[model samples]
Target: MSGDYSIYTGQKRTFTIPDYVLFSLTLAISAGIGLFFAIKDRNNVTSKEYHLGGKNMNILPVAMSLLVTFLSALTLLGTPVEMYNYSTMFWWLCLAFVSAMVLASVVFTPFFYNLQVTSVFQYLELRFSKPVRLLASFIYILQTCTYMSFVLYAPSLALNAVTGFHLWGSVAAVGIVVTLYTALGGMKAVLWANTFQALVIMAGLMAVLIQGSIVTGGFQNAWDIAGNRSRIYFHDFSFDPTTRHSFWSVVIGGSFFWTSLYGINQAQVQKALSCPSVSKAQIAFFVSLPGLILIVSLCCMIGIVMYAFYADCHPMDFNNLITTSDQLLPFFVMDILGHVPGLPGVFVSSLFSGSLSTISSSLNALGAIIPRDIMKPYCCPNISDRSITILSKVIVFMFGGVAIGLAVLASQLGSVMQSSYSVYSVLNGPLFGLFILGMFFPWANAWGALGGALTSLAFMSWIGFGAFANKVSTAKLSPVFTHGCNWSVTTTAMTVTTTLRTTTSFTGSTEVTTIAAPSYPFIPMYKLSYLFYMPTAMAVLVIVGLFVSLITGCRDPKTMDPRLICPLFDRLFPCMPEMILRPLRCGVNHKGNIRNKVYEEADELPEKIQPIDANGVEVKPPHDTEAGVLKGGAINQGFEPIDAKTPGSEECITHL
Candidate 1:
């Protein structure tokens, strides 16, 4: 009764034993390699060292880690299904890259760099309340828990369906292994493993693509078939709120999504921010842009190739196929290609890497968030760093446990694989909105932050639910020529010349299966293109929060806590750098700006902070619980960057 059961019973013949064994081994090995790294880096690094890699990490692995975070078992298994079912999202990933990298470099990275923060949620506490911070952290934990489970469970289902192993067993082995290494090694370990796994995933797909091409034809043949028959639907510029994949939805929604990811998402944010220098982190953003284009494009081509290969032996029912849609990729690999020994192992390892990298990053982040956001603020305000580190390890177990447990009944999400992004999008837009408000708008009060998040959440839920029901009511679209199609996650390269079109005109003798729920939702959710959900959510948040801030006009408290501010910001945001040109500038927290650090020496004026049209808000801006929107920053109030000696000798704190 799990979410995706439709896949198994009817598609059993297509999924075989060899596939399951290959899939399981990948998860087991990924976990083992991660643990060894954890132990090696154990003593010298603290939890900060463990989780954030002591901020001394390199960029190659960092950028790769980001790439793996976005890709997962879903990409491995479901992408080809998308290729089979509709327009393959080959370039869909490219769209994500253009938007992701630009935002990270131009705007998003600088915001974090300016602040010098560890957790994205921590920014909320500085401007708002502990409650706001905790809410965000809780939402993240919920997001990752559900997300990681499905990530792990997806390949498990693929393994079981192909190899006929129990789903729960697959979930347990992968879950335990990923969690163990993540708990031990922290962020560095996760990134290193991510680098390893990313390679494995790419290698696996290359194998499938190469063998599949020969089985089907050559590149030229695939091009002929795809060009002649396949509907690549590269760009659908006709914009309609109801339509799933369109240019506006991609460009606009994508912009918002990347902004939130780079700016607000804790797991993704930590990896880049963890870098010792700001320049390295910024480079991480640039590195992935090209990679995104290459890999995603290759994936869709592989899908077409799969279709061509199986033109003859043609497995499962076309419309009658019972498996959840995402399972298509796995079904192909196991049932069609599992006959090759090393190939299966490579495929499964790649699948495991995608899931492992993302989940491990999440677990490491949860460790940081729990102590910083909830546990320390409310319960143990003064808990030592060591205690905090120990507690984070415990949280990793909990995060993994819940995800694995849910994985057992994963069939409930109907399309647990696709729903992964939706789960995140639904919450992220609003959550990130709150933070956006804080960073940009000094006037945004705690109450506004709380209200903005609540409102955004409500709006997203309503739309999300409607979309889900629409998916339920609509009819499932299947290929017209049923004889050629087979059932498995990524298997579909048949090249018969039937016009690939679907129309819901079932009449007399047909027994119509209820259309599987929209795999997501339809409430102007705009087709099943939930890919842009987070950015869409972010849009709603920023707009709504800003409007509200204008109405209310409240402001963030001027006073800061001793521990709330990081030492890094003081140097960067010089009006508050505590240390001067000496060794004192090292890692120490400071309250005032470096400029302000002149400490009562210069008769200075406290600058007026222009209100921010801050980050995100629900349906309206919440910048003004204390109240505000976009305006000049606090430093703009008559302050200019001055060398220490000139300002010091003159005893002049000019508000320039």
Candidate 2:
């Protein structure tokens, strides 16, 4: 057999002419959007315009982009497999989605919108120091790179299962198309592409759900079978730190996870920032919530439908499914929708669309951050805007190349959803922590932020990697009971070696052994579910950061930029004794009592910084020459008030 012949011996259908045509059409539409915008707006292309979509993007497209970016192929494919293998506990994360959006809107959104920074890390520099900004930016870059590789890998693996397409070919095809459009059309192209792709994703998912339900008789029948088989457990109320996917973990820990992504990660934040106003951006966040919940719920239901269809004979038996659990979604689609001609293609296109939308957003965001954050400061300090724009496109191509290259070497890392989230929770916690400390704690200093971030990262690396290495074995929860379809199904147990023969097509193994050598001893903390990593690391960061700030001496609040602190904090704790507060207090009404005693001694004070006036214009500071320049240059460079009474404003460089 070229790869594995066992899985395809029966009536299973592969890709056909109509299927390929449909898939090609989907790709063409995406590229067409990019080409249309590239030619249409070529004349007015500027760094600000390209990177932020002229900072006037509508709320609907921005909302769709946010939803699609999070609902990538990782969620589309991996989620069903998660529900199939474990249970529906993952779906409850929708609750976390609500909390995350509320926090993002109430706490993080106003600050980012008000500050008007292209790279959100610029806020870190404004709040703490240059090193903190760079560290936070680098951490974000690392997280995206790692996540994008798997995002590209996932749907390709699915396509390979059904059509036998080479994994590397799928990777290159998707990567090149995403890069082409992202480089050519920029944020507008990305946003509109996401809007179209999001629709495709929903259509494909509904098609699968309806078809699978038909095959299983009805939705209620599928639910009954799934319930009987125990594939629908959602009430894990454990508070034990090690328990995976509990009520608290999914709700509380999930909030931090989603917040890190939506609140701090530049990819999602860039979409939100593209909107014309803070209220519009907040509207986008709110608009995304319903779609996010609906899509994930559908994915979870698909898992249940799969369980019902194979109730009598699970895919694990009889070369039953594709090589890995992730492949089951594709296999199920083929079984259910193969005879429908272009329908299978639609499903596959949706998978590809999911991958394309996410990778494109990451590429565009990476492009924006490079010249703005990394390259301009170190490589060419005085680089012109034209050079910077060119550099951004180059960085997109470079990172797209890296992600594709990594896709070739990538292998299945357990269930796709778990692997991606585990990686996210472990690495992104510190990045999120830096933002939290910056916005929430006025006393937090550079050493504290840096110290806490590094410590959390180190601890998570040890525990997270250790846990991945010493993989835990869980008992299969679902009892095998196929709905008695009598068309040559097998339920006999396969020996480990025989199972490996079929699995090697996707799992890339020829011989599997039941017992393997242990690489690392199990540790109690490492055994804790990956969901807890973010909240735990965040706690460590806050506790450690506050302690270090107190001991090391915090920056004076009056000397700190009021713009860098969260508006929620300003509104909530407007006053506290100066002895208890950090010595600096920049935004307080009592500035005259403390202003000159502090700001005059601050380093690199700007000659002048015009705070935003009631009319939304940058007016000259009430007092001149004493304001310290925020570490990063004026954050709201691209956004200037278009007209008086337009409610348009630039973020002021708050000088203490």
Worst 10 residues of 2 by lDDT: 496-505
Superposed Cα deviation of residue 27, candidate 2 (Å): 1.0
Candidate 1, lDDT over the whole model = 0.60
RMSD of 1: 11.2
Name the candidate that leads on lDDT: 2
For model 2 the TM-score comes to 0.84
What TM-score against the true fold does each predicted structure earn? 0.75, 0.84
C-alpha positional error of residue 233 in candidate 1 after TM-score superposition, expressed in Å: 1.6
lDDT of 1 by residue, 1-656 (tens): 12222221332333235544655566656676667776787666465676677777889999888877767877667667656655543346567668667766655665554555567775665455556667878877777776777788887777665555677787887788888988877887788888888787788888878876765557567555544443345656766644455666666666666667665678878887677666778888788667666666668877777555433323344433335656556666654355565566667667777788777887888888877777776799678777877888888888778878877545677666457667768877787677666654444555556667877888777666656656533333333234433344434332223222122222222332233543443233435357556655655666666566556544323322212223333324446533462234332123233332221222211111222211211123324221111111112112232343442211121111
lDDT of each: 0.60, 0.73
For model 2, how does the per-residue alpha-carbon lDDT over 529-647 read when each residue is reduced to its tens digit?
Answer: 78888988888888888887777665544443455555454333558655645434334223222222232223222323335332334444423321223332222212332233232
Candidate 2 off by > 4 Å: 1-9, 479-522, 569-656
